[model samples]
Target chain A: MSEPIKTDVVIVGAGPIGLFAVFELGLLDMKCHLIDILDKIGGQCAELYPEKPIYDIPGIPFTSAQGLVDALLQQIKPFNPLYHLNEMVETVEKIGDPLFRVTTDQGKVFEAKIVVIAAGGGSFQPKRPPIPGIEAYEGKSVHYAVRKMESFRDKRVLVVGGGDSALDWTLNLAPIASHLTLLHRRSEFRAAPDSVNKMMALVGDGKIDLVVGQVTALSGGDGQISKAMVKTNDGSAFEIACDALLPFFGLTMKLGPVANWGFELKNNELIPVDSAAFETSIPGIFAIGDINWYPGKLKLILSGFHEAALMAQKAYRYVYPEKRLVFQYTTSSTSLQKKLGVAPERPAAPARAAT
Target chain B: MVQITFIDSRGTARTVEGEAGSTVMETAIKNGVPEIEAECGGACACSTCHVYIEEAWREKVGEPSPMEEDMLDFAYNVQPNSRLSCQIKVREDLDGLIVRTPDRQA
Candidate 1:
């Protein structure tokens, strides 16, 4: 219920394209506030494939997913873009022409002149496991993702799935849990070998118990889990007593509230944008990155970069209708360099008198 | 150059020649073929460029990678011959390629 934070642009999604959009909008003297569902800045790059090598970036031969994110973070530091992580944008209302009010799931509101959706693949929602009556325990005992380790302290913790989140939370919460159990449908995990090794070591030391089974049911009272009925691959069923169940079943993308933002949509998901300014059906509202659709739209980061450049040009007119735009390349534009906090070259240091 | 024919949902077809070493999605975009939307530019990230390769040219275009297949899951009207046009590279042997786009991209 706090006062809505005001900015020139409100960018949804903190992916590499979103980050780059900050630089583009910043060069136009438009301050930005970026909102993302993930707790971190990088979207799939940092979350899904941080170390994965990406070979398609222009100008750079190759870079790791996270490396590109890190470079972009450094590049946008001069802009000082405000970040609102771990929050999903829930509502977008056009208050005026070229003015919008955006609200997040966390109750934070942002008022801006332009709303840019750089949301790659929309909002990432955790894939919930299929278990009868599990919905009642959600946000109480059965959690999809661990938000705080302190919440699991001195509690019976059962971590599920074979991904990195399962192994990570199991390792992190084992020391503090009254009893820790790691459960998965398969014996082999999709997590990193080192994390798997460390988890096995914990099992060896009796700090944790590894169960190869899937949760079929949850028995609890007053919206809290008391025990989990697990079914093993060998057709064996057993009950594991636990107070907290952490299921890391990976994430699925949802258009979320963005779908109802009053823009024309294709397939009831992505926003349809024009090729010129990447603007949606709504004026001053631009859609870039993977969340947008056009006749020749490409979901590549480089394509998003190009879209961001064009979006900023059109956005500048909306933010400053009277001011004429002068396009300039950063390689020779001193004002652009100044905006990026780069000092001018000192005339080749006067050659030091030929010393 | 490689000649590729794109068939729209309404059975309209457009034949265009694309330079070698570029992707089918890129070539289609450049030639203003409405079938392939190459949204993500030629990145295997979006399924907007989903297409059904002609049965005759299936062996030539080859199969999609597991990554590309995952993206195709989001595409509309995916068939057994479904492949992301972005993942299909233009080559000399890929001449006379024919593919049909879905009614709408998912």
Candidate 2:
């Protein structure tokens, strides 16, 4: 057994909610150990489409996922959370009163007074289309998304899907790709109206080709996509020569290691939790963010914020039962008031005339 | 609509109704089935949505993409039938298909 490191709290995920827990815990002068499967923090906010605009989150009227992550990082910078990235918590078990043991995949063990499961959507896995002989061209020409846009420059690219990502990438690659073809299973796109209009304009000018069909096969040798075979909605098949095939299909959320913890799930879907406290059936273990389920539950970033804040208060109470949380108010005298641009003398209190 | 059956590792059978055009992950998620965690929202980034198809459904579900296969290498309890549920789409002919979620997600 590896030597166990101890801490006040062990947060299971490093996403926005987990980071908020860390920030709150730090405010209370508590130590926290944050763990995540990804190499970076910000959870889904950082991992998902960073460039895409997110209008749902509160405070910022409109911010990209990456922008939100950057702002969150700045807020937690002072706390200096102990981050353990590129690691996944394999198992969590209650050992004693208000104490738990967390073990990682690498055989590392950690003992903590409390465990906060801020693992949003757990570990995200992208969905891939079922295409024959596509496996042989795994690393060669097939791709899920182009993290590096420069890679496909001057290349003949075929972008698939009717979603926003598909349209976004298609538009982005239009100028770079020597020949660009956009294929969708449906005639109408699910992308934003503006993007669809722009794509349509490009198609009208003969800048790109739009094909409504499903990719059936990939033809190439020595590990690269040389040509793509697509079947139209109407029993028609056509082969398009291409250097790269990019699929921008959307994603789905899954429950990871927590599935074995034996928490009751409604309809075997989301993990059920206490509606008031957001605690799972297991004491000292809680689920937050999109992974949680309850009566009147709203799965949103704003809702996760409320859940995280309330859970932190309850967690604090669990860790320190005797200590009463206190909010200190700083009182300023005349001298301090002057520095703050406040008048030295207080205005006369409103006359207390008998009503 | 496509009818699919998911048998959890604990041997609980759950039959879910899925649209022919949606991915298996979406079908399972919509029906409140506790399997596949399409963490990346079906973007083929995370492996929390790992599942093993029944021998009969393996050919029907087909093979996962290279990126998905690489991610499965990082999943817990990987098996020959192991596949990311988000990668498999539901079709009319895929009714009665069976899949088993792993004991753990990540």
Off by more than 4 A, model 1: A147-156, A162-164, A171-179, A186-208, A219-226, A346-355, B1-106
Chain A TM-score by candidate, in order: 0.84, 0.59
lDDT of 2 by residue, B3-89 (tens): 888888799999989998888899888888885666666765666788899998888788877656655644554556788888888
Candidate 2 local Cα displacement, residue A244, angstroms: 22
* C-alpha lDDT (0 to 100) for residue A258 of candidate 2: 76
**Reference contacts preserved by each model:** 0.00, 0.05
Which structure among the candidates has the greatest TM-score? Answer: 1
List model 2 lDDT by residue over A1-355, tens digit each: 8999898899888887887777666666567899987768877777666766778887689988878778877876766778898778889989988899999887889999888888877765445666767778765688875768888999999998876788899999999999999987656675788999999999999999999777888888988888988887567898999999987655434567877767777766577888677888887877787778888888788888788777777777778888997643225444323333453667899889898
Worst 10 residues of 1 chain B by lDDT: B69-78
Clashes by residue pair, model 1: A297-B38, A297-B39, A298-B38, A298-B39, A298-B40, A298-B41, A299-B39, A299-B40, A299-B41, A300-B40
Q: What is the DockQ of each candidate?
A: 0.05, 0.05
Model 2 CA deviation exceeding 4 Å by range:
A126-253, A327-355, B1-106
